[model samples]
Target chain A: MTTRTVAASKSGKLLNKLFPYLLLAPAFILVIVLNYIPIGESVLRSLYDWRGGSRATFVGLANFKELFQDMAFHISMKNMIKLLVFQLVVILTVPLLAAEYIFRLKNHPVLQNAFRVLFVLPMVVPRIVTVLIWQFIYDGDVGLLNGILKGLGLVSLARPWLDDPRLALYAIMFVGFPWVSGVATLIYLAGLENVESTVWDSCELDGARGLRRVFAIDIPLIFAQLRTMAVLTVIEVIGGYMFVDILVLTGGGPGWATMVPGLNLYENAFKFSRMGYACAMGLTLSLIALFITLLNMSLFGKKVDE
Target chain B: MRIRREDLIRLLVLGFLAVLTIAPFVITLFISFKTEAQFIRNPFGLSLPLHWSNYATAWAEVRKYLFNSIFACSIACVGALTTATLAAYAFARFSFWLDKFLFYVLMFLIMLPPIMSLVPRFLMVKRLGLLNTYGGLILPFMSGSQVTAMFILRSFFSGINESIFDAAQLDGASEGQILVRIVLPLSAPVLWTLAIMNIMTSWNNILWPLITLSSRELYPVTVGLMFFQGQYAIQRGPLMAGYIISSIPLVLLFMFASKSFIRGLSSGAVKM
Candidate 1:
């Protein structure tokens, strides 16, 4: 009886040690197969001249060499940079302003909640639908912008907003105009809410109110949220649904005006079947994203720590 | 009592911004109800005799896409939540060898942007014989959503009072039972928030399904809407109606669970 009880306790201890591994196995296995392994394959395949087949010939650095000289790739990179700049500026400022406006109405909790709900409501609309609606708005004829322009008799200014090479990228950027109706605003509002009441009291003692208080206290307090938004914005510009938007709207259109690297990579891999070259492009893009993410982290992260 | 001038100004600014934000949807609603002739006469204004038939035309085209989207997103959300919850509970409740290392390994993936691996992932799916199928769409979405769900759930689980878990353990409950009974019921709010967010994401996703499924019959609403727009390019009324039709599921979801939805969005920002 004594020997059996000891053996049972030993087995129970062993099971306790193994239980956590069993629990984590499903998640770890899925990510490894679906995410990490593919990432590894991307790196390896970048060096091989492989199509969508079993056979692959080693072609070290050739794909990367070709990528550097590709004019379309250069154009896409330049356009992506332009977009990154535009998005960074707009995302940082516009959402902050919108959140600030909502944060000021905190005393009226009902109105505050109403505004919060209203701001986040548009997010329910699918992104593709949003893009398509903008496509209609940018239509040369019978479009909302043009219709309004014609109504106001500004006919000269009402050309095809998306068809123009000079305007297409900008027009795409302008889709979510007054861009406060996103989760970024809510995140900022949440950050503002966490600011201690004593800070507000001190700001009031200093006679800092309105925009003055915002500059003095609120912005400083929400620096971490700003950093988070900035990092996410960078990652998004580099690799987000901008490609889908461009694909559906312009297809890189009238002379590669709105071409971005993600769309360029997609076209290479799927459309043109330049699999190796696409892999190389993917590596370069990921490296660029990583570099920027690290840079943003070090820059703002240190500030926040200090 | 007279309202303060500053408060009045603030209210006006908020109202104006709100109107500008919602203007597109409001215009789409108006356009969806107008006849082509009425639209040509006045594109921006609401016209008489609202053509409800436009919805019928849209519904016929949109229903298949809606069904596919609902089917795939539902599976992905449920799958993600299950795997992520188990993993989160493990990480929170137990400390084993490689615990921190494995957690960080999973966390590292959050930085690897999905676009970077898009080509290889496509090839991988093709190799697995999942191309042109719902598995191709649902599996990646489940994997992709795990990081955020795990991150959120793990933190929430860690915050629960340890005494409850201890009590359950002392009663001779297995770890699985403790998880299903104690942890899950306690974390319902977070799970609900994560589900809504995951569904919203998978529903909006376009690029993956666009590439994977060449079959028109299997297209999700986002991809299908693109084709629908092309087919009905000239028919503005029905096209606008289709866009509105596609938005109904999520909008209804928002109406019923607005608080959870809002919490999901805000907590989603805490990913970093």
Candidate 2:
């Protein structure tokens, strides 16, 4: 009986050691098969000349070479750069301003919560629906923007907002008007809440009033949150599928005016069956994203240390 | 007895911004209830004879896609949360040989943009014969979301009182029992938040489903709305109604679990 009990305890110890691995197996298997393998395959396939299904002949660097010379790709890159600048600016300003406003009303908890809920309410709407609603708003005839402009007696300025190539890209950028993103505002609010009451007391004692107080205390206190938002905005603008928006809104435009790199990549792979070229574009875009992210981290890391 | 000038000015500014933020949605709702003639007469304002039939027409078109979206998103959310929770528990509670290595591997994936693997993943899914099936959608979503879910869950699980876990272990409870009974119960709020975030992302996704599913029956609401818009380009009332109908599930989710929804949105910022 003693021997049997000892043997049972030994096996139980073995089982205890194996348990964590057993738990990890499911997620690991799925991640390996789905994410890691595909990423490896993407890197390999980008070097080959293949139409997705047929035998891929290795043509080293040719696809990348072609991508560099592609005029449409150049246009998309320029449009993306323009978009990135605009998005970063909007993200830094609008949501921070809104969060600061909400943060100032901390004494009035009821009003603070009300504003928080209202600001986040729009985010529950599906993004596609948001884009489509904007599509209708930018419609040539019987659209809200045009109707409002005409209502205000600015008839000359009420031309088809989306149909005009010069205005289409800007219109797409302006989809969520006033651009107070819920996520950004919430993040800033959380950051603002983290500031010690003692810090606030010192600022008040120093007589840092109005914009002086904001510039001196509020912005610096939320620098970490600002960095986070900046990085997120970069990833979003770079890696997001403007393909869907462009497809729904302009189909890359009245002549490649709004042709973003993501849409261009989609068109190459699926629409034109240039899968290899698309892979190269995807690789390039991802590298650019990775580079920018690292740059952002290092830059902010230095500032925070200082 | 009276509002301060500064406070009043702040209130006006915030109120004005709130109106601007919600104006598009409010306008969509009004237009959804208007007749085509009514919309044409006054595109930006409320009109008479609330046309409820537009919703019926829109519902007829949108119901299938909504069903597909709910079915797929729920599966993906639950699948991701379950797998991620188990993995996170192991990472949080145990110090095994491969623990640090595996954690780093998963963390590295968070930096790799999903768009990089788009083309190859599509090809692989096609080769596996999962293109139009629900598996193609659910599996990728589950895999893609696990890293973030695991990241969040592991941190939350780690912060729990270690003594409770030890006490449960000393009671001769197996690892599974300890997890299900102690860890999971302790971390319900975080799990709830993660589940809601997963569902919201799956619901909003368009590009993947659009590429994978060719059949009209398999289309999610996002893809369905695209085709719906194309077909109903001129029918403003029903088109606007379709947009609103597509949004109702998420809006309803927000209404019912506003606290969890808000928490989930903010928790996402904690990823970095």
Q: Would you estimate the TM-scores of all the predictions?
A: 0.96, 0.96
Clash-forming residue pairs, model 2: none
Across B1-272, the per-residue lDDT of candidate 1 in tens digits comes to: 35567656767888888899899999999999988899888787788899999999999999999999999999999999999998998999889999999988888776667888888999999999999999999999999998889988998888899899889989999888988888888877678778888998899888899899999999999999988998998888999999999999988887888876667556533434
Per-residue lDDT of candidate 2, residues B1-272 (tens digit): 36678778878989999999999999999999988788778776888789999999999999999999999999999999999998988898899997999988887777677888899899888988999999999999999888889988888888888788789878999778888888888777677767777898888888899899989999999999888888898888998999998888988877878786566555543534
Residue A274's lDDT within candidate 2 is 86
Candidate 1 chain A, run of 10 with poorest lDDT: A297-306
**How far in Å is the alpha carbon of B61 misplaced in model 1?**
0.7
Model 2 per-residue lDDT tens digits across residues A187-280: 8888888788899888878898789888888999888888877877777788864656777889888799999999899889999998888889
Worst 10 residues of 2 chain A by lDDT: A297-306
Indicate the residue-level lDDT of B209 in model 1: 97
Tell me the lDDT of candidate 1. Answer: 0.86
Summing lDDT over every window of 10 consecutive residues in candidate 1 chain B, give the lowest-scoring window.
Answer: B263-272
